[model samples]
Target: MSVKHDWYQSEAKVVITVLLRNAAEKHYAVEISGQRVHMTADDYELDLLLLHPIVPERSSHKAYSTKVEITLAKETGVRWEALEKPAAAAAAAAPPKAQAKNWDKLVSEEEKVEEKEAKGEAALNNLFKKIYSSSSPEVQKAMNKSFSESGGTVLSTNWGEVSKEKVTVKPPEGTEFREWDK
Candidate 1:
């Protein structure tokens, strides 16, 4: 069930005020983790993945007859744009030209895939993505054509070589690749 709630943040804390009448300790429950908040009052529920990290150990909630107020101590003094992280993430997805994601220290899409130390298939994929992203237009086109025409069995960055001929699928040893039936 939907319950009305108001959230605000100060330099030191984030406050969530749930409008729930007859709010009691037994009926209303609030749980605070590192950056997550889960509150329940009878049939109503409120969950928030906070925009910023909060000191869960120092957080607390008070229940009153008309409302239940939760106070979460902020780990840092950063003001939040939204009560939940998802809202903040969506807003950050399309950042302003000059203004970037420093507000949240959020990682870029490319950064998310490029790990510091990758291994095996992950490393290969990351390498391919990196190579493709940084390659010249000709190289990119060559790579795309080769990879696709070869059924993902070939990935070539040499435009001169790849453009000369159609890439034939090179199946791995012990594996057979057959054409799909019409």
Candidate 2:
């Protein structure tokens, strides 16, 4: 049979209740350390690393006919922010990967590959945002209007000096312009 646990916090202590139906006091063993808790019986074991520091001397447990109730003293008399660190962080910090399941391989391998591809797409989108913000007001207006319409394709603008006829030096009075050979 599997053991289930429920955790609750109060002003000064944290309470954990473990369901061990019809269990006697002799069949259970409980150990509480600075931030760790270990409880075991003939059929099951439970080990927990608390989120915050607790006073081990003040922690106690009592086993009843159907359950075991454990009370742990909070070091600072404050509520915990989280029950435990994230699974990924704990798995990375611990020496062994064996403690955590290889969920990526268990699920679809195709989705993992797709998620990596999506990161690249996200980077490209960020680049577009940068370019859009740096563009001129006229360009921004045109872009906004096009986006509001069905679709926008091209940006046309005169970026350089207007075209004009090339100027030539006037020939001396009454002298014809002569082409010179190299």
Candidate 3:
């Protein structure tokens, strides 16, 4: 199900034979590092979809059975080559320090922006609490009643309201009849 090999550059040829469970095998001629290698299947299970269905009566009578054969084409020329000298040297060289500096600056700016946003949110919350507390006692009572009935908590000091659930629901269907029965 999986293939693993050592690091190979662009041109590599390897021949591998995999033994399968169903007595079916596959041969692969792979090009590894510009070399062509031939691999033959060693007792590999054949894919059911690729295999012909066996007729039990005919098979019993026959001395030999038919098998499916698959051939894969190989690249004639050099499939892989080593990287050019100049490009390889440049890639091996150390990267510029400016990239790291820019990344650090970006991170610092993001943190500052997040801090400002959090401060603004706290200020807005405080303003809301002050306004809610300064309102008339009747308004405060009404707000508290609404908050409690809707599964919310109204803080005493700040008069800030926090609700457990955001959504409101309407009475269920046939509630009038149910109420009458009760």
Candidate 4:
């Protein structure tokens, strides 16, 4: 009879479960070397080439009525992709051949992304905010003073120029700056 088996793992250990009808029978023999697991019984045969070396002295197995559980402690705490070498290879398929990228298509994609960004008053405010956030203390001070005193009309980053004069309210063309009622 064909013995069905499945394997799972953690960071430190791997457990292989073998499904057999008469698991309680003591006719099974399990042998473990550095990188191999061999088990045999009356009508069952399980042989596997482990993906990585395991601690032979620390490996063990227990038999129950439903299944036989084999526990193997890994020699190193490395992440295992699969229980067997061939399984690991099959899980990771062969890579595709490298090719040059399409430069024109890539450039058009980048331009389209830029076009999607806000280009109105919000974008201008975001630009000024980014500059102010990354600038030095003096530049931040100048930007704060100019933007507040100019009635949202001007934003200056030059501390030397801004510190020399008082920023006056200069509203946009056709818009007049008026004081709030106090």
lDDT of 1: 0.79
Residues 1-182 of candidate 2 have per-residue lDDT tens digits of: 34678777898999888888765743888899887777788876776666788899999999888899999999997777654455664554433211323445766576555545766768656555656778887656554544433122333222221112222335457866554562
What is the C-alpha local distance difference test score of each model? 0.79, 0.66, 0.33, 0.78
Model 3 ranges with Cα > 4 A deviation: 1-121, 153-182
Give the per-residue lDDT digits (tens) of candidate 4, residues 41-148.
786777777789999899999988888899999999999876777645534633221122355799878856765685997676667666777899999999899988
Which residue pairs clash within candidate 2?
Answer: none
List, residue by residue over 93-154, the lDDT tens digit for candidate 3.
43211111244588878856755676676765756565676888755755665555444433
TM-score of predicted structure 3: 0.19
Which of the numbered candidates is closest to the native, going by highest lDDT?
Answer: 1
- True-structure lDDT of candidate 3: 0.33
What are the RMSDs of all candidates, in order? 14.3, 18.6, 22.4, 13.6
lDDT, candidate 3, residue 141? Answer: 59
| Poorest lDDT segment (10 consecutive residues) of candidate 3 | 46-55
Per-residue error (Å), model 1, residue 45: 0.8
**Which of the two candidates, 3 or 4, achieves a greater lDDT against the reference?**
4
